[model samples]
Every structure is written in structure tokens, then in C-alpha cells.
Target: MNEAWQQALSRVPELLAAHVQISVSALALAMLICLPLAIWAARSPRVAAVTLTIASLIQTIPGLALLALFYPLLLGVSALIGGGISAFGFLPALLALTLYALLPILRNAVTGLTGVDPAAQEAADGLGMTGSQKLYYVEAPLAAPTIMAGIRTAAVWTIGAATLSTTVGQPSLGDLIFAGLQTQNWTLVLAGCLFSAALAISVDLLLGLIERGIRERRRIWAWAGLAMIAAGLLVATLPLMIARDNIVVIGAKGFSEQYILARLIGSRLEEAGYAVRYRDGLGSAVVYQALSEGDVDVYVDYSGTIWTNQMQRSDNLPKAEMLEAIAQWSSHSHGVKMLGALGFENTYAFAVRPEDARAKSLRTLDDLARVSSDFNFGTDVEFLERPEWQMVRDAYPIRFKNARSFSPTFMYPALVSGEVDVISAFSSDGRIAANGLVVLADPKGAVPSYEAILLLAPARAGDQKFVAAINPLIDAITVDNMREANYMVDREGDKKTPRQAARWLNEKLRE
Candidate 1:
């Protein structure tokens, strides 16, 4: 436990810096747009109503959904203009968070400006002051306190929402949170939450000081608050300013296997003298798109995922033919290189408790279908939406009494606790065996092959050193070794960090 906390703490500086950078940038951008708009809206009630309504509508959209929505929107725009815009990472996250911060700042600023004393405005007019002069000398100072209050609110909100940017591929404290949740590592989750909450609280306190300073007419207090914030931002940005070359950005989906593989890949790259960074917890579609766009240098993707999700193919082919077709399509269509399979499969398997399987005489999909109406199905959050699930439903007459979604980490526990009768388990997950669950046979072959495949970005496809560095991984990891590695991380007692598990797997490859 102490070691786990140490490992989790070691990562905090980099993640916290990234979290601060994005939060501050979004807040600053929100202020830039909102303050100007507020000045205009203060003069026109119609403008105020419309702008505020739009901001409110934006707020109504869930942060995660808003972040996810931008990927396709930006992709469409990029396609229309011949594809230069990146739909992943900082841009999408920035845009979503900026929009989120708008309402608080805009509403408060407008309220402050419009609510300025009428007598003061008259006095300025009587003094023959021009409109701009009145605003600059009189209205602005009086409105400063309220405007700062809005900024304080916006700062806290932006800091909180910025954590969601991890989904869009931006590195933030949320990476720790999301990865922890997936792996059930409470230490990591606690570390992420603690740092994020601390940063938000600190920023709010500083901004509150500025607000108070303005209200109390204390310039020293305001300057002191501003100085501290400047210092903090400088500290946060220093690491980013240092120039580093040949940095490889690895992308991974939200699961233990993906995390382990990413670290394994990173370890190999680092041995080859490349600086490494990871973008974990990417969605299935988003990770592939990111690689194709060169936002990610390399990552592992399943052959079946590329086939059904990317190729839009419904028909099943032999494993070799499917891999060949996927490779050809990826190289030709998107310039992505299908490096090779990792000699293992993590296909979705319908697993039930061994006792239940025996009691129901369920050994296959056909058997499961016979008793489906009495069972409750549990799946990873994405499985129900995946093409594989739809294909299974089409192939089988199975219809569960109820279905629920959970994080991959919780699905096995749900099965063990009898909260769920069955789950869409990964064939390579160790917990399936650990819990002695039985995976129903798919005699119909409706589910496509899901051999784990490494993919390279277009730019790296021709790089011999890059290719050679990763080539050893092809056909290296057996399913047994992978399950062992995953179990090392996923197991409740004496859990290994993904990096440690990767190291253990790498040693197995050597043997």
C-alpha cells in the first residue's frame, strides 16, 4: 500500500501541471470572450437574454458528452476542408471547457455592469464624459468587484470541468482517476481526487482574495493574489517549455490490458532513446482516429474493432483473412500500418458463474438463449454499444430480463457477488479464471476474431528504428502471460502497477 501510494504520488507533478495548464487556459479564454460580450450585453437586454440562454444550453450538455461530441464535429470540419484540423486532444478539450466556463462569467459581468448606480452614470454624463471614458473611469471600477466574483466562480468551475478533458485525449488529473476506476486502484483514484480538489480550492482562494481586494479597495491584496497565481502558472508551465525531441505519444483504451501494453510499448521505446508519453483511457473510435491523424504515434487495437467499427463490415471472415483485409485497408485507406498481432485475443466472452452454468446446463449461446429471460446481463460500459454486441444479439435469440453497465473493474465482482447473472467478459482477463466462471461457447461464430494488433501512425510507418523498436512485441505475448499480467494489476491483494506488470510480461517474452 505504501509502495502504491509512492508510485501514484510520483505521477502527480506531471498530471497536476497538465491539469493546471488546461484549467487556467480555459478560464482565461472564457474571461477573454465573456468580458467583452458582457460589456455589450449590459447595454442591450435582448443580447443578454440570447447569449445567456445559449450559455445555459451549453451547460445543460453533460461535460463528458460535450467533450465526446467535439471529436466527430471537428472530424467533419476537417474532412470538409481537406483534413488538417485535429479532432483529438487539446483543441476539443479547450473548446468544450471554454464554453462551459462562459455562463458564470458572462452572467455575473453583465449583472455587475448593468447594476452600476444610475446616479453615477448621470454624474459622468453631466461631467461631459464620453461613453468610453465613463465606462473606463467610473463604471469599470465600481463593477470590478462583481466581475472578480464571477471570475472566481469561473475559475473553480473550469478547474473542476477540466478533469473531463482526459476523455478527449488531453492529459489531466482525471487520467489517474479514470485509470484507477478501471483498475480498481483506490490509491490512484484518491491521489487524483486529492490533487484536483486541492488545485481547485487553491485557485478559488486566490481568486477570492482578488475579489475581496477589489471590493475593499486594497491594491496590495489584489497584486499579491495576482502574483501568487502568476507564480503557480509559471511553475505549472515550466516542464512543458523545456524542448524535448522524438517524444512518442502512446494511446490506450480504458482497461488493464491496454494500460499494460502501453507501458510495455513505452518501455521498449524508451530503451531505444525516445521520450515517451501516454494518453490512456481513450475511447475505441477516438484512439484510432487519433493515430490516423498522427496525434498518437502508436497504440494497440483489436483486429475485430477495426473490422466492424472502422470498416463497417458485418460479415465474418477467417482470422487470417480478416487480419489481412484489415491490414490492407488500414494501410491503403488511412495510411496507418497494421504492425502485427500480439499473439493473443481479448474477445468478448459471455461468462457465467460455474455453478450457475452447471445448474442451467448452459455451455453455449444456444443454451444461454433458452434461459436468457431469467438472467440479468452485465457488460462493460462500451460493450452494449459495440458492434460485437449487436452482432451477438443478431446471431442468438438471447434476450436478458435486464441489462446493466459497469466499469471493466467491477464487472467480475458483480458476477461474483451475484449482482449479475452473466457478463461480457474479456477472454484474456484473469478474473474469469480466478472466479472460476465459465465462458459460454460461441458455436455460431457470430463474434469476429479480436486478435490484439499494434498500429503505427502514418508518419512512423516508414521509420525503420520506430518499427524495429516495436517489432519484437509482435507474436510475443501469449494469452496465458497476458492474463497473468492483467491479474497482477487487477487482483485485489498485492496489486502490481501497470508498469510493474509490463515489466513482468517483458521478462516472460525474453524467456
Candidate 2:
């Protein structure tokens, strides 16, 4: 627990900078976007009704779903624009958060502006003031407190929700929370929650001071509030502004194991004197594309994933031959270099709770095939769509009574808790042993070998020093070692951060 806090605290500066950058930027933009519409709507009730309705509709979309939806939508835009936009990271996160921040600000702005005293406006008109002048000098000043209240509410909401940015490759305090949740480290989660709450409370107080100053005509409080806001913004954005140019950007897919491996590789690179950074939570296809396009310098990917998903090959080559083919195909096709396998296979395997498997005598896919309709099948969202699943089904003629897809995080618990009777389990996942699940054998070789292979971008292919730094890890992490490292993070009540687990793996390798 102390170690988890140490790890979480160490990342505070970086994560806090990212969190503020996203939240502040989103709130600022949302204010800019919504305020004008709101002011205009204040003049036109019909327009206000329509615009408010739209903003309310946007707020109804679940936060995580909104963030996920941006990826495919931006990917399409990038395709149309000949590929300049990134589908992940700050852009999508900022855009999604900005949309979420809109309704409150817009609603309050409309209410504040419309609620302004009509007699005040008449007095301003009597002074021969133009419509814009009356709005600026009379209505705006009178309505400042109410509008500022909305902005305050928005600032707090944006800061709290900004934590979700981690899901789309944007780093934030949520990174700690997500890592903690995945690893089951309550200390880390608590730290993130506590810190984020503090930030919200602090910002709300400061903004409240500013609002009170405006309402009461207190110049001292107004100036002090403004100064604090400026100082905060400067502190928040400074780290991002002075970013290093030579950092090696590593990529990882959206999962706990991927997060651990990326951190492990990144820590190793850092020790080797390379400046390292991670662009994690990438979609599988995006990571590969990012690697090929030089957006990412390195990442670990499975040989079978490349062979089938990327290479579009269906033939079941022998393990050695498959690795060779994957290496050759990647190098020739995408300018990707296969460094070497990491000595473990995390292939897709059918798993059932031990008691259920024993009761059914489900020792192999063949056994499951005979009574396929007796159980419900569960799998990660992507598995059912993958070619490997099609191959498995064709080979075994197995079909469960029902099949449901879940996020990787939920799939195992779903299977173990009897929500589903069988699951497509990652063969090397630590959870299999932790939960005491039995993996059914695939004697017919339906699933291909899934060597955890290291890959390099084309430009780095000839950098032997860089290659050598990572090459020693090839074939160093045995299945047991990998599983144990993963378990160190996944096991309940004794979890380690990814870096801690990675460091343990390094120590084992040295021994």
C-alpha cells in the first residue's frame, strides 16, 4: 500500500499537468463555444430551446461511450483529410470533454442574460447606447454573478470528468486510477480520487471568490482570484509546453497487460539512457499504424495477431515457421521489424471455472463441442470478430447456448461468477491461475501460436544499440515468469504497479 502511494505520488506532477491541461482547455473552449450561442439565445427563446435541447442530448451520452465514439469518427475524418489528425490522445479527449462541459455553461448563460433587469436595459438605451453597448455595459455586468456560477460549475465538472481522458491515450490522474483498478491497488485509486477532489474544491473556491467579487464590487478579491487563475493555468500548461523532442514514444493497446508491458519496456529504455514516453490505450490497428508511420518508436505485438489480423493470412504455419513468416511479411509490407519473441504465448484458449470444467469433463475443445449448447460463452469484445474465432468454431463445431461480449476487464469475472459458463481466455493471463479456471486444450491447433514479439519501426531497424538494449529480453520472459509478473499486478489485495512488476521481472532476469 505504501509502495502504491509512492508510485502514484511520483507521477503526480506529470499526471496533474495533463489533467489540468485537458480540463482547463476543454472548459475554456466550451465557454467560448457556448457563451456566444447562449447570449444570442437569450435574445431568442425559440433558438434557446433548440440549442439547449441539443446540449442536453449531448450530456445524455455516457462519458466513456462519448470518448470511445470519437476514435472511429476522427479516424474517418483523418482518412478524408489524407491522414493528419490523430484519433486518440488529447484531441479526442478534449473534444469529448468540451461537449460535456457545454450544457451547464450554456444553460446558465442563457438564464443569467435573460434574467437581467429590463429597466436597466431601458436606461442604457436612454443613454443612446447601441444594442451591443447595452449588452456589454449593462446586461453583462448585471448578469456576471449568475454566469460565473455556471462557469464555476462547469470548471468543477470538467476537472472531475477529465480523469476519463486516460481511456483514450490522454494521460491524467485517471491513469493512476485505471492502473490501480486494473492492478487492484486501492491506495493508488484513493490517491487519485483524493487529489482530483482537492483540485475541484480548490478551483471551485477560487472561482467562487471571483464570482463574489463581481457581485459585490470587491476589487481586491477579483484581482486576487484572477492572479490565482493565471498562476494555475501557467503551472498546468508549462510541463506540456517545454516537452522534450527526443523522447522515444512507445505504444500499447487498451488493457492491463499491455499497460504493464509498455511500462516495462519504457523503464528498460529509460535505464538504457533513452528518453521514454508512452502513448497507451491505443486501438490495436492504430498502434501498428502509428508504429509504421513513425508516430511510435516501439511496442510489443503478438506474432499471430500480425499474421492473421494485419497480414490477412489464414494458413496455420508451424510455430517457428509462423514467426519467420510474420517477421518477413511485416518487414516487407509495413516497414516493421520483428525483434524477437518474448518467450511466452498469450494465445486464445477456452476456459471454464475449475468445478464446472471438472463436472463437465471438459478437457479439450472436442469435449466442449459434444455438449456446446449446455454452457454460455463469454469473450472480450474483439474476439468474436477475429478470424481465429471463426477458425476455432469451424474446426470444433462448438456453439454455446449463448455468447456475450464484454470488456477484457469484465470477461474473467463474468465467467468465474457464473454470469457465463465459458470464456475465451488469454492463455498466459495471470487471472486463469488466480481464479482457478481450467483452460480447455485445442488439440486440433485451431488457435495459432501467439508469441509475445517485440517490434521496431523501420527507421530504428539498423540501430543495433537500440536493438541490443531490448534484444536480451527476447526469449528471457518464460510463460511462468510472465504470468507471475502479470499476477503481481492482477492478484487481489497484493497488487503492484506495472513498473513495480516490470522491475521484479528485470530482477528475475538478472538473477
Question: What is the clash count for each candidate, in the order shown?
Answer: 0, 0
Looking at candidate 2, the ten consecutive residues that score lowest on lDDT are 502-511
* RMSD in Å for all candidates: 1.3, 2.8
| Best candidate according to TM-score | 1
Put down candidate 2 lDDT per residue, 24-79, tens digits, no spaces. Answer: 88999999999899889999999999999999999999988898888789989998
Q: Cα miss at 44, model 1 (Å)?
A: 0.7
Mark the regions of model 2 whose C-alpha exceeds 4 Å error after superposition.
241-243, 279-281, 293-295, 307-317, 320-334, 354-359, 385-387, 403-420, 434-436, 508-511
Rate residue 254 of model 2 by lDDT.
63
Report lDDT per candidate: 0.92, 0.86
TM-score of 1: 0.98
Say which candidate scores most in lDDT: 1
Each model's TM-score?
A: 0.98, 0.90
